[model samples]
Target: MIAIAIKNLSYHYPDRTPALLDINLQVKRGLKTAILGMNGSGKTTLLYHLNGVIPVESGEVQVFGTPVVKERITEVRRMVGLLFDNPDNQLFSTTLRNDIAFGPRNLRLEPALVHRKVEEAMQLLSIEDLADRPPYCLSLGQKKRAAIAGLISMEPQVLVFDEPFSGLDPALGRQFRELLDELVSGGCTLVYSTHDVDLAYAWADEVVLMHSGRVLKSGPVDLLCDEKTMMRANLPVPLLGRLFQGWNEKPRTLEEALNLMGSTGLAKGKRLQA
Candidate 1:
């Protein structure tokens, strides 16, 4: 099943500045997909259309076979959860606990059910300690966690995140990644945008490369190995890609690269000690 389908999608800012042009893409159900691009590449603008955050000005966007239009926007939003790059845009409640409980409450679920969802989300995000604190008093990372907790409490089927790693420390980043894995394992579809080629290369099952509001290329993770395409998109080759530049085989993760390098003695000086 296709989780998202976008065709001939185009958008322009209020000032008439083109933000997206003739985009055509599809994300498979339950797969991890990345929108890879440089800054000002229209990554965020394209994401907004997935959940009807930005109404389609031209062409169409469909989430799980439902067209993103006013008539079906509620249904679309219910299925797809979007996490903004800046937490401030999503976290508006006076208290962190209330912010996390906002979505579940909006659904009009029983108060007990809403409370349970809030507690689960807070525990998953490790922000239970900040429950009573005002959002303004927390650090940027804490705010990001709170925002994520709020979204998770909704339990949307498709998760769309814009630069999800922006404010997370290493430990928090790893924790969030594990949570994403758990969600996907439970049959959720994941889509995220990022300018980090290395992260996309190592993490995404597929990627759509964008440049100047246009899709330069879209394909399996192997597409990142295309030096010409990466150059055209103004993105450097991923670290692993550069290391395996001329090799017949390219490994996606560090552990795989290390194994291959050890077996082939590709490392210049002594092979990585076991």
Candidate 2:
């Protein structure tokens, strides 16, 4: 089923020009979709509409079959969780534990249930050790995970990340990818706005490419990364994807590509994997 649908969406900041125009998007439940664009191409604006953080200025936005309006704001918020680009902007509590528990507490769930949620989220993000420390005391990576833990405490059906892959080192990026896989395995829909064409192609089941506030392409990852579409969409071809293209292979995971490369001696004398 469609978890979120945006039809012919148009929006503009009150003091600025249009940020998005003639946009159309559909996100399926329990799947991972990436909204990809260069900076200032309305990816974040589209994410706001999906999370119901901003009112739709024109066209229509539906969350779980309900139109996002004044009355359905709470429901929309409950159905979708947004993780901001900067963790400091989102994590405000004095202690990390309290911050993670904030959302369920606000929902008035039982204390025991709230505690369970916080523990689970902390474990998922591997931030359980930072539970009692203040958010500001944590490192950049820990703070990001804590902020995400806070959002996960609410148990929203749809999870949206605004550049989750940003500022993370290779190790932390791998951790976050594992966390996303677990979330999707548990039937949560995931959407992320990003400029990392490589990560978008690697992690997203489906990709939506935006240019100048309009969709240049939207389809399964394979089709989105096709040479013609990547060129026409003005996106750099991911190295792994480019290798897949040149070899005309259907390998899915990075490990498969590694195994293939070793067997075929493709990277024997080159800096291919690195």
Stretches of candidate 2 exceeding 4 Å from the true structure: 262-274
* Candidate 1 all-Cα RMSD: 1.9
Please give the TM-score that candidate 2 achieves against the real structure: 0.91
Worst 10 residues of 1 by lDDT: 265-274
> Which model scores highest in TM-score?
1
Q: Against the unseen true structure, what C-alpha lDDT does each candidate score?
A: 0.92, 0.85
User: Which tens-of-lDDT digit does each residue in 1-274 have in candidate 2?
Assistant: 8988889899989986788898888989989998887778788888888767778899999878989888888888888899888888888888999999999998899999999999999998888888999999988888988888889889889998999877777897898889788889999999998888777767889989887788888888776557776777677877687667767675666888888877778766466656
TM-score for every candidate vs. truth?
0.95, 0.91
Q: Count the clashes in each prediction.
A: 0, 0
